[model samples]
Target: MPTLTIRNLDDRLKQRLRLRAAQHGWSMEQEARVILAQVLETPAQNDGAAWLQRVRQRFQGVAGDDWQPSDRREGTERELPHFDP
Candidate 1:
């Protein structure tokens, strides 16, 4: 068993923690332990690029040439003016 000491806890925060613990039918220490356990046990997705790539790969075959804007000839393409100033 390990011992943990928390210091400088505000009175208002301690009161809120006590209320939350009571709501869940747990002591303040037990509630804190449960929260710590849950937070530590969960795995986080840290790679945004990898997630985006996976999503793009999943829906890769859904679109076709018929859905492209160039496929539909509505009018002549006008290029936007490039401002250098």
Candidate 2:
């Protein structure tokens, strides 16, 4: 395995990474490796599709054919409030 060295990273970002690694019970190096692998392996379309699938799955029951969008036309003609000095 080859060792990687990163340069000029922000101090805050490093702290955030350390905190996140601790939250996930990982060493900073292991967490970085996992993040790198995930980012490299997943294509953007696949990531988007996966996210859409998860959302659809979550609302599958409420998203039935009976659903209807409410009208936005009612507010279109409303007058703006006059601010008098």
Candidate 3:
């Protein structure tokens, strides 16, 4: 196991951490370890593909089995106006 030290942490923040640790029935060090593990183990959602995947996963099967796509196509192209170039 390795030892980690945080230098010059705010007194108020440390006090709050201590209170939280006591509330959760853990020591300050143990609570810090738990917090670090939780925050560090989670995957990042910053990538566009990752975000899209999460969105798809959340709404999976939300449309039900009866959903169908409409057959739509682009409209006819319009002629460009004559310009004196």
Candidate 4:
């Protein structure tokens, strides 16, 4: 594994990390690794539009406020499903 050196980390932040490490029965380094792993496992959702686009792509033909009947030529639409955070 590659080595990582954190320079000029805040004293209070370091203290908090130490306490968290102790509470989890892990070394500060191990705690940091676990935190990083958990965070990176999820895709970032900072962009609402982009997140909505992904949902549409994943559920294509099943969602969107612009949905229409395959046989209909008129501009009919339906409400997209509500998603909770």
Q: Write the per-residue lDDT of candidate 2 for residues 14-76, one digit (tens) a residue.
A: 999999999999899999999999988877755788889888989887846887777878678
Stretches of candidate 1 above 4 Å error? 45-85
Q: Which ten residues in a row have the lowest lDDT in candidate 1?
A: 65-74
* Each candidate: RMSD: 4.8, 7.1, 5.5, 13.2
Best by TM-score: 3
**What TM-score does each of the candidates earn?**
0.54, 0.51, 0.59, 0.56
TM-score of 2: 0.51
Off by over 4 Å in 4: 47-50, 53-85
Give lDDT tens digits, candidate 4, residues 1-85. 8988999999999999999999999999999998888899867777798889888889887645776657675567777999999
Clashes of 1: 0
- Prediction 3 TM-score vs. true: 0.59
Clashing pairs in 4: none
Worst 10 residues of 4 by lDDT: 67-76
CA RMSD (A), model 4:
13.2
Pairs with steric clashes in candidate 3:
none
* Clashes per candidate, residues 3 or more apart or on different chains: 0, 0, 0, 0
Alpha carbon lDDT at 17, candidate 3: 92
- Tell me which of candidates 1 and 3 scores higher on TM-score: 3
Model 3 has an lDDT value of: 0.90
- Cand. 2 Cα-lDDT: 0.89
